[model samples]
Target chain A: MSSLGMADKVAIALVLLALAGQLFFQSARRRAPYSKLRKVNAYQSADLLISAVAEKGRRLVLGIGNNLTDQGASLSGVAGLPLLKAISRRSLFNDQKLQTVSGDGVLACLSQMVTHGAYQNAVAVELFQPGEAVLAGTTRFASLAGLLPEVNHRANGGVILSGQFEGETLLALDLAARKNILVAGSTASLGGQAAFLAGVCNLALGEDYYAPAASLETDPAAAASLRAQDLLRIIIAIALLVGAGLTIAGVL
Target chain B: MKKGLPIAVAILSGLFVLAGLIFQPYLGPYLGLVLNWAVIVGSMALLVAIASLIIYHARSILTARKGFIFSIVILASFGLSLVGGLWLGVDNPAYLKWVGAIQRPLEVSLLGLVALIMTSAAVQVFRNRGWSPLTVSFGLSAIFFLLIALGLLQTLEVPQIATVIGYIRQLPLVGARGLLIGVAIGAVMMAIRVLLGSERPYSD
Candidate 1:
């Protein structure tokens, strides 16, 4: 095969252009609206989550999953942070107690996000204690083990497991199930398998994790990125169909 | 100052790591070597955690606190596991056999305990929550049923049930695939947020 074919070169150029456009729009602070499909469940589960945390007067265990600094890009963590902020804001607005536990060094980041959310809702910073919001552990099983007891003992009102998770997610879900807590879970690309195994997540947000933040916060950059992603998915789907057709026709 | 410094270090280190990722072809090996030092530091932190666990347990034992027996068991397990690994070697068949024997019962018992807890909790929720519980219960039960019906519960030896369950499990993959595709797109957006420093995760 040639080092670089015409089609390959064009494809690479398109990808680069898309990435560059994304970077430019993100930097410029452009907001994009939901591309028709995602606006479906805008605030369906949000009210329940908010009420569970704010009115119920029970602790909210926000498991940010195993995506920490050492754990790479943490696509799930990014997606979950906005949702955490939104939930935290609602909790604070309702004068409800909100506690977060993270399995990675992202504790500081998560703590700040929660603190900021609290601040936005005119709540005290002291309420968002670094200790309360953070539990440092590495590895999935260890994190889950460390977290399960806390969730159970606290009688957490709502358990949000949004981020990158793995096989250990089953253990967390099992723990939540045992505790009779409201559990909402969303995973990024890597978390699909774990998400599949979780039999009882109340609100299974799937990839629409970014939707809560994007739709709720109206974060323009996130919205724009989501739009770009929609375009990309459509393009990829079309490409797949074409490829399949060609294959079926016995074309190279 | 204490919190600030760590945050600062995290930000600097994170930026370096991101830069390394972007220019990995040229900087990958050297960056990897630097990250190996990070691994060593992390391992040392793990040691601190283990030490903290020992200290807490020892304190509990001396104070005759609740779950002292559990502490003793933990300490004994830790000591025995360490000694056995070092003296008998991790690969030693005798050590493996002893560990496995202990492990099997512990695992099975823990799993069984979880199952019991889940059952009790489910009953309590249904009993107490009333109408609202129905939606959640139904969703959870459906998923649980599907997961079990699928090959996940195949070890129980009901082939007919497993076949039906497998097809049911396969049904959701299409929706899951769509969701995954959407998530991938969102992830790219998030990555851009990080790379452009717009998200500012390290910022307080």
Candidate 2:
């Protein structure tokens, strides 16, 4: 739309460099004897659920929350796509395939693509079923009424509600609890966080939403992104503390 | 090109939006056009989603699934909404009223469930986790939550109570702000990955 300004250019350059640095780490780690690792239960649980659900003869359900949009929760959903692909790929031979329920139209589209890609990897392009990803509803809560029944009945007992979710998360999580299904979800909103804390499921709070994606990749570069996020978080916390202190001292 | 084309479009769209936000002079004029195109594409996706949903439920009904009636209801709702939105025009008061009639109740009911879910979860947490930091916080918040929600603690009646509530309110705000910052960083990382073609969701 417009030319990038100096600050805009700088920010873009910094982000690109940071991402590139992560890639460099990914490549370099291949040669290194060892690399630091972090445990994210969300990804581990996804893997666990694959086996658990398969053994139980139940399908693994992926609830890509309806929060996905061009502006809102798009990145969060996009970040989780790799894992969706991973899970879909991993669950190829299972009796029940991965069932994706999404509330947003755009996300439903991407999820279909992800499912198809996974199939293309696992078997053949012809076997890619577009129905793998179902559109539940347009809004978060509206989607819940349509989604919960599907998960409760078809999924057998596994659900992952990772995406840009708002208040409606509580219902899905509650339904999961009633069905005694394993549920783990991440929330980006304050209300959603509260609901999540109170809902019956494994929690992915705040930015931990990206943990599944990077952890699932296990690429040193992808993992480096987590470290970069941690660095940024620390800086922000420090800035907040400084701001609070300065405000207390009546300084602008 | 399966992966390359989508990633390229994403990078271009992302940069255009970023430039529009930061520069606002040169790129701002085309921002609306780009956004409009996004809306059109998104609408197309929604249309496809509708078709998929219908086909899905139709299959269920054909199979005589236990809850096949629910499929009929879902289809009817879709038809009604389509007719309302398309025939009446989205801006028409009839459409607006119809939306509010349906959405308001759903929103309220869903929000109402939040309270019950929170209470049940808090109780379960205490029983299972046995009073961890989270449970303890929930317990403490429960006391003030009732006092504030029930309007027992009048802000004007007691200046100290008002100050306390105000301070407590700021806690969640601060946490939310921090979380937003975290989410932003994560988003940036994802954008960078897409731009670099390191992470392509479109291709195997």
Candidate 3:
């Protein structure tokens, strides 16, 4: 083993903290029968839209943005897969179609795989349609242009944007608005978050984008993850406060 | 074993990567190898996705689906681009310029439209959310930042006022850092989940 650098030490500490948090929450969940999750408007609205679309027998679209393979965004890209799995599990049995559009090739395949897994879990493996997950475009704008048709024509119920997206998401938001399709979105990108805040009121901003499984109650581990995030946030806030105090005191 | 195997592979690979990160001096070359493998696999996935996309568009055309015309246009463009890339070689300067010429303008125009749409969305935000605490703060902060960005605040040369402006200018960065920290924590939690085999997106 190599000697740990400061960054490595910090990384290890964070990982251990998360693991401890997860185990603590998991044990706590076993002791208590209830797990209360704070309500998020994005997931709540998405639930309504999914049911409404299912009732109307219209297609529901999930847009996994184009940055899945991007160096800085690979984790954000994979983060949406769990959300996709939850969504596909919920909506796959409906007679209405559940389609996914991705800007990146690897993301499209992963989405297809997740949907397939959902179908398998539901014992509807034969009904799984790989083509439902489409690589709309490889680049950002091309993906936006490719996605608009899906949003405008097929998303009769609504579209859920989850993944890393840029400001191009606004154009999709604009079309979804005009079409009267309910749009709920979450993006890791700050620019995309700003657009969502301005355009689509039902959005998961900042770290909330990563809490889909917890918000939807799809996985217990997801709930644990949420708790861990909360713990970390508190610790960070305290650290920042202390740092500021120390700086003011000329002791930092 | 089908489900178990993917989970095992995922957990092992994830742990290996984490270990490599923690032991970079000793394991850097192995990490590089694994990353190269990932790159290759990703490229192959891309190829498969492109093929599937072509099939999807071709099927849309054959079935005479609504807006199938767009699919035809997409296929034609793809075909032309493929032919050009193959015949002229992707490294050729002319080919690179030709692709860039089409790509750059489309991206720029879309960015312009997004700016216009974003401007409109500022109004949409107020209209839809209707002055809730969050929206009110968002609106005020947005206006505050926009005004500051326009250098309207710079005309105030008073020492106290300049100091306040300096403090105010740091607000965006502070907010951004807060968001980044939260996002980073979330990302870390996700990686941990994958490593622990608690949430398996690959198999389940």
Candidate 4:
């Protein structure tokens, strides 16, 4: 700690602060549930689409974006897991297909495990298939190409994309829109967010990308994490405002 | 114990890594070892993923599914790439060029298609979002940025115009920074959740 630079120290302080917030919220929720997560249009749309697809005997697709490895934007990739499990659990007994696709090998494997676990929890192990989760392509464009066919054929109900992706994913969103299938997406990348804003999807932007699990009320810890995120967001916003004011006042 | 073991391992390792990052001078070697182990495990997982992919395509071909022909094509391409990579060594220039010749154009063409889709999507944004304040602001900002990006404003070269353009560019930076802070906070909270065993995204 003595050898660490100023920036490193600040980063450490921030992490510790957030960690403290998380622990506090986690214990608080265990005592009494936190139920005040703000509404998210994307999750609502997903629920409606799932019901529609289940009724129509069609399928739904979840694109667990490509940036899942250590070398890429992995946090946002891992962030999609809770949503994957939630979707799999929700769609389990309905006889409607739920397929997941990813460009990264590790992410695809994790998705397969989570999906299979969902089946296990539902007591429907016989219905689970290995092909339900797929490694579409190792590269971004190839993965998009691999996913388009599934979107074309199976996504009769809707497509929900929740992961770290780039601008190319808008092409998939566009394709889904053309087919009149319900589309919803979220990404932590700026370009991807812009693309989603332009496309016809119920979109979750910025911190909302991390709120799906909490919004669904599936896991108490997720709700706690969202609270921690909000606490830190408020802290950072106040700091930014103060800094701007100081600069405007000619105080360094 | 099956679940508890993974959670414990995750928590301890996460703590150790965090400590190592903070106190790097003392625990650098241990940090390297842990990261190397992670790399090894990740590589093995990749192998398993590839094997599963091959098996999936094989089953499709065996069952003569609707797109069985594409399965055959995928498998053939996989085979060719694997054999070529093994025989010629992946770093060989000829092998790299051989792969790149096919990969580069396909990726570029896909990107071109994405640009076209983006243009169409931009047009549809108005229709889909209607005349709401958010959509109106988005439309106006986008058109403003597009004109700036095309150098139409730059061509005028007036001092006041350039100053206003500079301020406009800084406006996006402010919004971008706000978004970045939110994303960073969310990511840190998620990591903390994993460390505390409140979330088990890696649980099988």
Each candidate: what lDDT? Answer: 0.61, 0.73, 0.83, 0.85
Off by over 4 Å in 2: A1-34, A70-74, A218-220, A242-252, B151-162
lDDT of 1 by residue, B1-204 (tens): 844665556656766876676567777897998788777765664465455556666776998976588669778888998899999999999999998898767666656665564554455544433556554754576668767756467877897977777686685676668777666566656665555554544333
Q: Give the per-residue Cα lDDT of candidate 3 at A34.
A: 28
| Candidates in descending TM-score order | 4, 3, 2, 1
Q: In terms of TM-score, which candidate is strongest?
A: 4
Model 3 chain A: ten consecutive residues of lowest lDDT: A30-39
Comparing 1 and 4 on lDDT, the stronger one:
4
The residue-by-residue lDDT of candidate 1 on A1-252, one tens digit each, is 244567766555645655775666555554334444355242445547667566667777776666655656455665666666666656664444565666665443445455555664574665543344554355555566666665675546767776666644656676666677767666664443433233356444444665655556445666556555656767778877998899999994
Score candidate 2 by DockQ: 0.56
lDDT of 2 by residue, B54-166 (tens): 89889878998889999989888888988988998989997999889988997897788777876777777677557688789878877777778887787358888888888
Any residue pairs clashing in model 3, and if so which? none
* Model 2 CAPRI quality: medium
Better of 1 and 4 by TM-score: 4
- Give DockQ per model, in order: 0.20, 0.56, 0.72, 0.77
**Fnat values, candidates in order:** 0.22, 0.58, 0.70, 0.71
Residue A106 of model 1, lDDT score: 45
Q: What is the lDDT of residue B99 in candidate 4?
A: 97
Higher-ranked by DockQ: 2 or 3: 3
State TM-scores per candidate. 0.64, 0.88, 0.95, 0.96
